[model samples]
Target: MADSLATWMPPLASLDDALLRYLDQTGVAVLVKDLTSGRFTAASPCAPRVLVASQDIVGQTDAELFDAVQAVALRAADQQAVALGTAYAGEHRIERHGERREYVVWRHPVPASGEQGPRILSCWQDVTEQRKRDVLVQATLAQLEEQQKANAELRREMQDNQVRDSVSGLYHRAHFEEQLRREADLSSREQREFAIVSVSIDGMDQIRETYGADSCERVVEALGRLLKANTRAMDSPCRLGGDRFTVLLSGVGLATAHSRMEHLRKACSQHIVAFNGQQIPFTVSMGVASFPHTAGSVEELMRSADRAMAASRAKGGNHLTLASIQFVPAT
Candidate 1:
C-alpha cells in the first residue's frame, strides 16, 4: 500500500524537492516567513552563510535581529506587499558583523491552502560593490562639473584682462591695434569698407605742470570713461598713449567717420573734469581715414591720419580733419 501511494505521487513534487536541494548545495539561499506571525518558517541551509544570523531568525520577527526603526520599516514594506498582492524589490543597507553591508531584496506573497495561512518569501543578494560604484560615479560627475565651471571662469578673466587698459581701465592700444589689423585684412579680402579715427588732446603738458601726476591720472581715467560711454560695440575705442586715443569703426566710410568724429568732438566739449572744486574744460583735435581710400597697411593708414591731425592742430586745435585730402599713395 505504501509503494502504491508513492507511485501515485506526481513526478513534479519530486522534481521540486530535487531542485530545492540543488539550490541549497549550490549556496543559493531561500527563506519563507509567516506574514501574520512575522516569523521565518523555512530557511535553506545556505542562508546562514549569506545572511547574518539566518539560523537564529527562523522563528523570530525582524525586531529580534534589527533595530526598532529598521524592523518597523521592514514590517511596513512587507504589509504593503501583502495588501497589494504584488512583489516588492529594492536595495537596503544592514549592519552585519560590525560592518555596514548593502543588499538587493525581493519580497513576494505566497497564497496558502485552507489549513495553512498566507506567507511571504524574501530573497536577498549582496550589492555592496554596486552601491560603491554608484557613489563613485556621482562623485566623479560632480567633480567634472566643478572643473568645467572653474575653467569657464578662468577663460572669462583672461579675456577681460586682455581687453582692459592697464592704466585707465579702458580699452588698451594693443587691443585697438589688433582690431585695426583684423578689420584691414577683412576689408582688403572681402572688399568691405572701414574707418580709423585718431584724437590727440591739447594742452596735456600744461595740465601736468599745473596739477600733480595723480591729478593727470584722474583726468585720463575720466576721459577713458567718457570714451567708453560714447562708443558703440562695433567701434573699438582705445587709449593709444598719453593724451592720444584711437577708434576703429567697422563697415564705415570716410564721410561717416568724419560725422562720428564731429559727434565725439561735441561730446568732449560738453565734458568737464572737476578737481578740488574746480572745473577744467578740455579740447581734442581728431583725424579720420578710410581703408583703400587713404593708404594700404595699418601703419601707413595711421601715419596718414597723424599727418591730418598735425594739419588740424596747425590750423588752431579743436577741429576734425580728413586724411584722404592729404593721403599720398605709396609707389
Candidate 2:
C-alpha cells in the first residue's frame, strides 16, 4: 500500500506555485541543489538578480560557476548545513555583471525524492543598500565620537584658563581660596593635618618707586615661578595681592611645612629680576600654620599665617616663622 501511494502521489504543483508566488511578492531568490552531486536543481526568477541564473546555473556545481574564493565559502556553508542537519545563514558578497553586490544567504536540508539524491534548499535576498547604510552609520558614529573628544578637551582648556592666574599660570587667588576652604572642610571632617603658608615680598614700594610697576610685576612673576618650582605637586601657590602670595600644603606637619617654607625663601632670595639692564634682588618672608594645630577653619588659619608673616618681616625680611600651634583637646 505504501508503494502504491508513493507511485500515485500527485506532484507538488500547488506548493511550488505558492512558493513561486511568495518569492515574487517578497523579492526573495530561491535555489535548490543536489547535495550528493553539488549541482543546482531549481532556480527561481529572482535568482538571476542575486547571481544565480536559472538557465546557466541548473546542474552546475558552485565550483564551476564561482571563483575559487566564492566556491570555497559556498561549499563550506553547504557542508556545514548538511553535516549538522540544520539551516545555515550568512552574508556573502558576489560579483555579477561586472558589479559587486551583497546578499543574505540561507541553506536548509531538503528531503530527497525517489530519483533525486539528498538535496539542500538555498535562498537569498539582496542586502547591498542595507550594508551601505550600516557602513555609513558606523563611520558617522566614529566621526561624532572624535568630535565629542575634541570638544571636551577644548572645554577643559577654557575652564583651566578661567581658574588660572594670567601672569603666573598658577591658580588665581580666588580659586586658591576656594580650594583652601574645601581642603579645610575635608581636614576637619577627617581629622587630618594641613598647613597654609603666606608669603609677603618686603620693600615692594621702594622697588616700584625705583624701577616702575612693570619692573615690580616682573619681580612678582619671577617669585611666582620660584615658588612653584620649589613647591610639591600637592601644594597650591597663589598670588593673594600685590607683593603677597599664599600656599596650601595638604597632609604636611609643622616640621615638613617649615622645611618647605625655608626652601621657598632660598629660592626667592636667589631669584633676581632684570630691568633696564639692571639686576634687582628681592626676598620673601613666609609664615606657616597647620589645621587643628593652629586653627580649625580656613579663615583662622589664613589670619594666623598672615600675622606670623608680618612678625617675620619685623624680625628681618627673609625669614620663616611657624605660627603657634593650638590643638583642641580630644573629647
Candidate 3:
C-alpha cells in the first residue's frame, strides 16, 4: 500500500496538484525528501502539523528544519528505509514550544523518474493524545483490579469472620500466624524459601497527638490499601495490633522481599492522609527476613524481622532493612 502511494503519479501537472490538494483536504501530513540532496522537495498543507510550524519546507534539509539530534535521527531512519527498499514505520518524540509530542511515521522509497533522483515519501500522524488515553486506560484497569481484590477479601472475611481490624481490613494476627505456618510447611516440603516482613508505622504516636486519633486511622487505611494493591493473592498482609503490621511472601527470597518492601516504604512515605481538609503525612519502617535463610524456626524468624524493623526505625524511618544470613563453619 505504501509503495502504491509513493509510485502513483499522473501524467499531467494539473493532476499532480489535484492529488496533493486531495491529500491536504484529507488532513494527511505528507512530505517528499530528495534522497540525493537530502532535502525536502515537496510537502502537503497538513505537513506543518507533524513537523515545524513553517508553511514552506520545500527546499529545507532536516538539519535546517529540526534540532541537531532529531535531524540526525530522522536522516538515519530515512537512510535505513532506503537501504531496505521497503516501507518503514516508527514512533518519534519531538519537543515543540515547551511541550512534548509523539508522532507515528511511515517512510517509503519512490523510484527515480526523469531528472528527479530517488525520493522518500513520508507520512506522519500526531499520537500524543492517543498515547495519553492509553496510559489513562491502563491506570484505570489497575485501580479496578485493586478494587476487585479488596471486594474479594471482604467477602472472605464475611464468610469466615477472619478480619482483625475494621479500618484497615487486614487479616488478624492469628490468621497471619496460621498462614505463615502453612507457608513454612509447604516451603520445607518443596525445598524452597519464603519471606516475611515486619512493618511499623513511624511517628504514629506523634501523628495521633498532633492530628487527633482519627488521623492515625486514616493513615492505617491508606497503608492497608497500598499493601493489598501491591501484594498477590497468595501473600498475606496482617495487622499485629497498634501501628505494627506483617506481610508473608510465599516462596520469595530475602533480596526480592527487600526490594518489594522498599517500594512499599517509599509509597508510604509519599502518601498523605487527608482528613477534615487537613493533610496528615506518615511513613513506615520495614524489616525483610526469609525462611531457612535468616531463621530456622518461626520464633527465630519473627525475632530476626523485629530486630531489622527496629534498626530501620532507628535510622529515622521510611527505610527497609534485610536480616543478615548466618553462616556456619565447616568441621
Candidate 4:
C-alpha cells in the first residue's frame, strides 16, 4: 500500500530521527504531508494497515489518493484544520479491501516556511476492539455491583451475630463469653472478685402462649431497660439467648450483687410492657455467684449462677437467690 503512494509523494525530505522512531513504535498509523505541494512526505510502519488511500500515491495530491467524492470531502476538512492551526479530529468510516471499518483520525497543521510550505501531520486509530471492550466493561460493572451488595449483606449478618442481639439491642452471648474470660483473668490477676448474676424471664413459654410473639419482644425490651437502669457503668450486661440475661459486676462482692439483683427484680416486676393496647406484666428469676467464693473458674461460676437461677425458677418465678459454693481443692 505504501509502495503505491511512494510514486505520488514528493522525494523524501530531511526527517527527524525521533519523529520516525515515535511513528515506528506507536500502534496507530502516522504520516506527514505537504498540503501546499499536494504530496506525501513520510509514513509510519502501520501505513499499510490504515492507509488504503492509494498505492500510486507518491507526488499525487489528495485528489489522486482517493476518489473524486472522498477527495473533495477530505480537502474541505484539511482546509478547516489548517485554518485553526490545531489538530482536527473525528471518527470516519472507509471501505478497505471490500470491508468497511471505523477509524478515528486526527489532522494537525504544522506551520512551515519556504519550500517546506504548510505541512499536515496525521494519525488514525482503529476503534473496533475498543467498542467491544467497552461493552464487556459495562457487564463487568454490573457484576461488581451485585457482588458488593452481597458482601454488604454478609457483613451486616456477621456484625449482628458477633456483638448485638437483633431484637433487644443488648450484647449477645458471644460478647458475654468473651467478656467473661477477660473479667475472670482481670479478677484473678488483681486478687479481686466480680459477681456473675444470671437472670431469666419467668414462665416465658406461658407468656409467649398467652400474649403472642410481639408481646415477647416488648417484654424483652422492657427487661433490657430495667437491667440498664439498675446496673453500674463497669458492669457487663448480656443477653444469653431466649429471655435469659447475665451481668458481670466488676469489683462487687456477693452482698452487693444480691442487693443490685434484688432491686432489678423489683423494678422488672413493677414495670409493665404495653403492646397493642394491652398491658403485659412479666417477671424474672435471678441467681448470683462470685469468683473464688461461689466458684473457682469461669465455667464453674457460670454453672453456679445458672443452677441458682434454676432453683429460684423451680421454687416460683421472680425470685433472686445466692449460690454458696466454697472453692475446694481435690485431695
Q: What clash count goes with each model?
A: 0, 0, 0, 14
Give, for candidate 4, the lowest lDDT window spanning 10 residues: 4-13
Predicted candidate 2 versus true structure: per-residue lDDT over 55-143, tens digit per residue: 47777888888778988988888888888898888878987657788889888876676776788778888888888999999999999
Model 1 ranges off by over 4 Å = 1-33, 36-88, 91-105, 108-164, 169-175, 226-235, 255-283, 294-300, 307-331
Tens digits of lDDT, candidate 1, 1-331 = 1122123222213425565567667555566778778887666666776667644657777888777877887888788778889888866687877878777778887787465578877776767777899999999999999999999999987897888876666677778887888898889889987888888887788877786566677777777777777677888988888888888888888998888788878877787888877677777888888887887778888888888888777877788899964447599
Best by TM-score: 2
**Ordered list by TM-score, greatest first:** 2, 1, 3, 4
Candidate 2 weakest ten by summed lDDT: 1-10
Please list the residue runs of candidate 3 whose C-alpha ends up more than 4 Å from where it truly belongs after superposition.
1-157
Write down the lDDT that model 4 would get: 0.80
| Candidate 3 residue lDDT tens string, 14-130 | 335566657667665788888999988776667876665664787889888778998889999998998999999988898766788888889998778797889998887788888
Return the top candidate by lDDT. Answer: 3
| RMSD, one per candidate, in order | 7.7, 6.1, 14.9, 9.3
Worst 10 residues of 1 by lDDT: 1-10
- Put down candidate 4 lDDT per residue, 1-331, tens digits, no spaces: 3433333224333445455456556657767778877677766666656666547444567677666776677777778889888889977666566766577889988777655678887777777668678889999999999999999999988886678776776788877888889888998999999999999999888888998977898898888878878887778889888888999998988998999899999998898888888889889999999997999989999999999999999989899989986947799
Better of 1 and 3 by TM-score: 1
